[model samples]
Structures are given as structure tokens and as C-alpha cells.
Target: MSEILFITREPFAIQGNSRPALHIMPDAVYALVVTDPSLDFEENRAEPGYGTLLYKAPASSDSSDEETTGQTTLHRFAFTRKDLRSTCTEAPVVLKLLEIAKKLKAHVLSDYGALYFRDENGLVNVTEDAQAKSYIMGDKGTRYALTPDGALADPASLPAYLAENDFSFLPETQAEPRAEQPQHSEKPEKPQANSHAPAAPDYCKGMGTLKCSLFSRAYQKNVQLSINAYYAWCLSFLSGINCGYQDFPEQMLRYPIYPSTSNEDIAFLNAYCTRNPDDPFISACLALRTMRLERQ
Candidate 1:
């Protein structure tokens, strides 16, 4: 509600360069300009008679009094692109700014048209198009297209939309996922003694395999762990089953979901995984195997 903090790259009229700056009301209602100490803006003035003055951010210590001289002086701490780029190892500039803004409960001002922020539901984007009253809510690959009345769309309404439609909506029918043909090698790891007894379940009708792309985007948006970690966790579910990348050809299994998997079914699998975080696949597979044994 209050004037949110903003980080932006300001374009220079004369120098043909853009510099990153932090916008804040350190003590007053008006914003004060701060720039890198290394940039010599005075030399690049548009006219010989025209000159502009700027506050140079302290080179070494922000706590130092040198940069905070007069009534015009603003808060001492300021950062350059290099400073931010080096410090934020987690992500690139814009993404890192979104991370900081989210943490501080602040907003970023931008002319780039798209505003990305981290929310309770993960990363969200509010983008503006060239059309007068055109806007988009959500990411690039998102199927949901939201166009509001004005150029700027309120992100506050996103939660309600999320409540109504969590992430994606699956159609009534999906194509059956085709299974990858088994590859043969001269030397292969033998299936575990118990793994072979449990034949693929009825639920696994088609050649069951999952594409790496499913996890790729999910990995990027995930904050808890690296993409590799998520991928590894997904694969870990099959380690004991002798289903995935292993020597056993006949027992090769794909993720139970296929192109034909209904939205409800996919949601169910997601819910099952969420409920049984420790071992969803193993539990499902074990249950199927038990059912088969019971029938025998």
C-alpha cells in the first residue's frame, strides 16, 4: 500500500548507456537519484552549457558519512549491476530483484512491460501488450490467457483465479502416452528378485514414459530445490522397482500418466504424491502388486 521500493535501469540521454539504480524515500516523500561512482556523467553532457549533478553511491562503505553530506543527501546504501550480479548466485538480475522484492514485501517499477513476482503459489507474471487495453497474466507457456479492462492488471485477483483453477485444467481426454521401445545392451543389470514378480499394473496400459520437459519448467519455478534434485527425487521412486533406466527390458515402465490421462486422473496422481511425499510411486506400485497377488 505504501510507496513500494523500486529497482530500475535508467537510460542516459547523452552517454548511450543505462545504469541500474534503487528508488526509495530514505527520509522524504521525493526520490533521490543515486548512481555508480565510476560513471563520469559530467563529461557526456548533451550541450557544453548544460550540466547535471548526481549523487555518487559510496564506493566502499555505505555506513560512511562521505556520501551523506547535505540536506539533499539520501540513504547511503546503493548497488550497481555488477554488485547485484555478483552477490545473487541464485538467479539473474530481474529474477533476483523479484526475489528481493518478494522478501521485502515491496514492488518493482519497470518499463519492460512484464512484471514478475514470487507469490505464495510461486512465480507470477503480469505482462502488458501494445494494444491499449491488453494485458496477460501468467507465464509464457501458460494456457490461461487473462485480459483485463486496463493496461495494468491487478495481481491481487490472481489468488481467486488460482483458487478456482489450480495451475492447469486438463481436458476430458488425452492421447495415450506411447511407450519408448526398450533398448538392448550386451551387459545389463538384472532386475531385482522381487521386482519382476509384480507385473506392470492395468493402469499402465500404454508404454509408460515421462518426458523430461514435464520437470524442466517445474524445476525452474521451484524454489525449494535445484531442478536436478527434483528430477533425482522423481527417478528415486523407481530405483527399487527395476522399471526405469535399467537392464530389464520386459519390465520397462513409464510414469503412469499418459497423454490420454484425464485432468482428474493427473490431479489425483498429484494429490497422491502430495499426500504420500515419502514414497508415492512405491506405494502405488506395491498396492498394485498386492492386488495382483490377492487375485492369484
Candidate 2:
């Protein structure tokens, strides 16, 4: 909900602190957490960091600067933690998150064991926007404002923060995430569950990186393969990849697969909405509830 939240104290952080520790604080009011009705732009914060509060994502002007901290080096941007925190309206919340990280003594990437993920380039790159966001949000919390390598500089501060505050993870956190890898695997050298085995899907090869973790877990067993009319349409689109132009009318709903939507499904939806007036089942249901007592 679009509601302004007044913090008991202003939130701000010292210059150096860990990203994960800062993310887990209750005093750190997330734009998503504090709003009762949720404003239009509050939920759409773009590109991580302080950008989490507002949605305007200035396209990453960052170049992939390669840096070697010696062991297994990667490309990552260099930015200060203080600069990122100032983007938020509230200072106390930001300070609280920083304090939490300082007390936890947790290294956002190392504690989470996500530092080693390699991207398509075979580099354990940390400068990528996605990588930065992952580390910033690595700590358990709804809202966050942190930067890459922000945690490495200040592990000692985290313990003190943990001593003062008691924090908990969100319920949605229990959902089986696709990307969590075991801390130390017998086959850390191998990607899939069975290293000795021949292999599984080609996509499985990307499993070692943190980016593919969630997807890897899902690919292991969650997704079921089946065919339906939508599947047929999807196949048709796939089959048309190399084909010459044909006058096939595109469907509206995902009638197929990834690019779902069928002309038929769209037609059905439109017809259903026209008859019911509310346009969708959700709207129809809401209308029903709104009028339920009125009719009586």
C-alpha cells in the first residue's frame, strides 16, 4: 500500500558494513514492507541497492571492469556503500541494516557460499548488476540497500549488530528456491547431483553458478513435460523459427509455452469478460463479494 512510514529513529549506516547483515533488519523498513496499500512505484524498484525503494532503473552505465584480488579473480564494479545508502528517504532503516550486518560478521558472498558462481564467460564475475543485487539481497529481509564487496570490509561490525537485534526470515523464504547449493559437496568438481554419471540436460551444465542455482534445482525435478493445445501452438512457433513468412494469426494468451497465449484463449477471455462485465475471474469474484451482502 502507498503509505508513508515514520521510523522511530532516522536510519543511516557507517561507511563500511556487510550487505547481507544490513538486509536482515526489522528496523530497516523496506518500501515493500511498510506500505499498507502499496504505492504505484514503491514495489518496482529497479537494479537493486537503493534503487529498491523506487523503480527508476537507470540502465547500468557500468563497464565490466576486470579486477584480480588474486584467487580466482572476476569482473566487478567498484562502488562505495555510503553512496548507495543515501538514495533512500529514511536514514535510520539504512543504519539499522548496516548495524545488523556488522553484528552478523557475515560476508554476503562467502557466508552465503555464492561467491564462486561462474557466468557464461567462465569468470566468477561479481560486477554484474544481477550479481550485485544477489549479494545485496543475500541477507534475509524484505528490503535492502547495499553494494558488492560491501560485506567483505567489515565482518567484525556484524557481531555487534546481531547482539542488539533479533531478526527473522519471511514466510515466503521457506519456498524451495531453485539455486541453493550445498556448502561443500563431495563433487564440488561436478555440477549435477551425479558427477560420475554420463550427464542430463545441457542446461544442467550451468548449475554450478549462483545465477542458475534456482533454475538448476527446478530442472532437477520440478518441471513436468506435457503437451496441450497451447503446447502445439508453442511448437508451431518453434517450428516456424526457420520457416518463411506465413499468415498465421498470433494468439493473445500464452497458448503455447514460454511465449504463452493463444488466439483461442484470448478470444475465450474476451468473451467471458464481455458476458461477466468484470473482465477477469478475479474481478468477477471481487464484484460478487462486493455485492454479496447488498443483494441480501
Candidate 3:
């Protein structure tokens, strides 16, 4: 499904570079923005009123936490430091958000925040290379990342990348019927003691591209294979397929695991591989076997 990736610093954490690393998909169907309580408010403030409503709370609630503090007309809620987490209405909420931000003249962005949305062509980022920390707002249900530069460069050439990576798109529609093999037109079969067997299907190529990208960037260096690596792999793999299923990789646990870490895991992975040897993640990883990066 479509998702939004919210890139933000770990509010109060004191370790590692405060760069974007977490991936947050929108958990609900609405979009909203919560204003800093310090900002002055007026009920009739927004011109032509973009259906903007003022959220009220007891002064005591503000000191408690975000959950206890506000009441919106809608229920499902999520938040970020910039308070872009609010109720989404019938209209495209981001446009309304831009309107509200302009009206409030609030210091609208974090030092470095960006909004990344998926389009037919692939994913695109609204903000590029934000200098410091910043904030982004949208109701696009897209994925996000907190990068210093706010860019996730596309693979060098997507088709070539996909092909070279050995990923294949599933047939979008029903298949045409095949003519039957000619009956009783048998030529003498060649008899050999050891004719070469068909090559094993390559399943690791694209998955390996993910591993290489992570390793080159030190995201997976010296780490045991974990779900986070798998999650990143799923994200990278989904970026290439044109299967027409918008919610590809809906959950990481559903992604295939080939080249399993143990015999038991291998048993399961092999079963999946047997059924889907040309699976996108596996095929791509096998095709792009030479994924080692050369650095200066």
C-alpha cells in the first residue's frame, strides 16, 4: 500500500549521527497538523476557512503528553515533532497544510525534513539536501527517510537495473493460450550418460543489491542478518518491480528469505524458492552477483 516515510531525529537520544534512519508509514487514513501551543490562535483565522478547526485542551493536558492533550473531530491519530500529525479531512490535506503554514507564518520546517511520495515512475522527494534538521508534511500515504540531503537516488537505469538485477514483473492480465506441442512428431532423443542439467534459478541478485547497498553504506556491516536489513531489502526490491500491485511488500515478514541462515530457515526458504525461483528479490540478487562497491 502507499505510505509516508517520516524522517526525524530521535527526539532525545544521545548517540550516533542524528540523520534519517527510521521508516514510518502512515497508520491511518487522515492528515493533520498540530500547532505549537505557544502560537496565538483565532477560530476564524484561516481565510475562506480550509475547514480548519481549532483543537482545545486543558492547560494541564499540555504538560502531560501529546495523547492526553488534544481533541480533534477525528479519532485515529499520529504525531511528529513538527505537529504535522492531525486529522485528515475530505480534501487533499497537504495543500490545506501549506495554506495554514503560510497563514500562521510559523517557523514551518525542521532544519532538514523532506516528503517522499511514490509515483508511476518511482519515488520522488519534495525537499532535496536540506542543510540541518527540518519538517515535511503530506497526506500522500507515501514512504519517507530522514536524509541530510533528502534524496534516494534511483538505480542507475531502472529497466537495465531491473533486468540486470534479474527482477521480473508479473503478467498484469490474463495470459494468451498456448498451441499444443505437435503430437506424434517425435525425433530420437539424444542419449547421454550425463547431459548438463539446467542451471539453478538465481534468487539472490536483487536481494544482494540490497545487501551491497546496505553494506557499502555501512548500514549492515558486521551485523547479524535481521529484519531491519530484510526491511530495507524489501523497500529496495519494491522500488524496481512493475507488478501493478501498489501495496507490494505490505509487510516484511511476507518477503521471501532465500540463502537462509540455518537449515530450518533454509527448509522454509527453499520451499518458497521452489515455488517462486524467479521471485523478484532472489532473481535480482542472483543477477547482480558482483555487487561489491569500489571506494577511493
Best by TM-score: 1
What candidate 3 gets wrong by more than 4 Å, as runs, is 5-82, 86-91, 103-113, 116-125, 131-296
TM per candidate: 0.19, 0.17, 0.17
Model 1 compared with the native: what TM-score?
A: 0.19
Q: How well does candidate 1 score on lDDT at residue 108?
A: 41
- What is candidate 2's lDDT per residue for 221-291, written digit by digit as tens? 43423113322433343344325324432211122223333322222222222332312233222222112
Q: What shift in Å separates residue 192 of candidate 3 from its native position after superposition?
A: 86
Clashes of 2: 40
**Candidate 1 local lDDT, 112-149, one digit each (tens):** 43344545666544434333213222211122222342
Q: What TM-score does structure 3 among the candidates reach? A: 0.17
- Candidate 3 structure quality by residue, lDDT tens digits, 1-296: 22332222221122342222221211110111212232222222222111223333322212111234344222122333223333332223333333443332221222233433323554332444343233322222122222334332232332332332121111221132557545577995653211111232455353443322333233224344543454456445544442444574332123243443222232222222222233333432322211110000
Evaluate all candidate structures by whole-model CA lDDT and list the values in order. 0.30, 0.27, 0.29
The global Cα lDDT (0 to 1) of model 3 is 0.29
Pairwise TM-score winner, candidates 1 and 3:
1
Worst 10 residues of 2 by lDDT: 1-10
Query: Regarding TM-score, does 2 or 3 come out ahead?
Result: 3
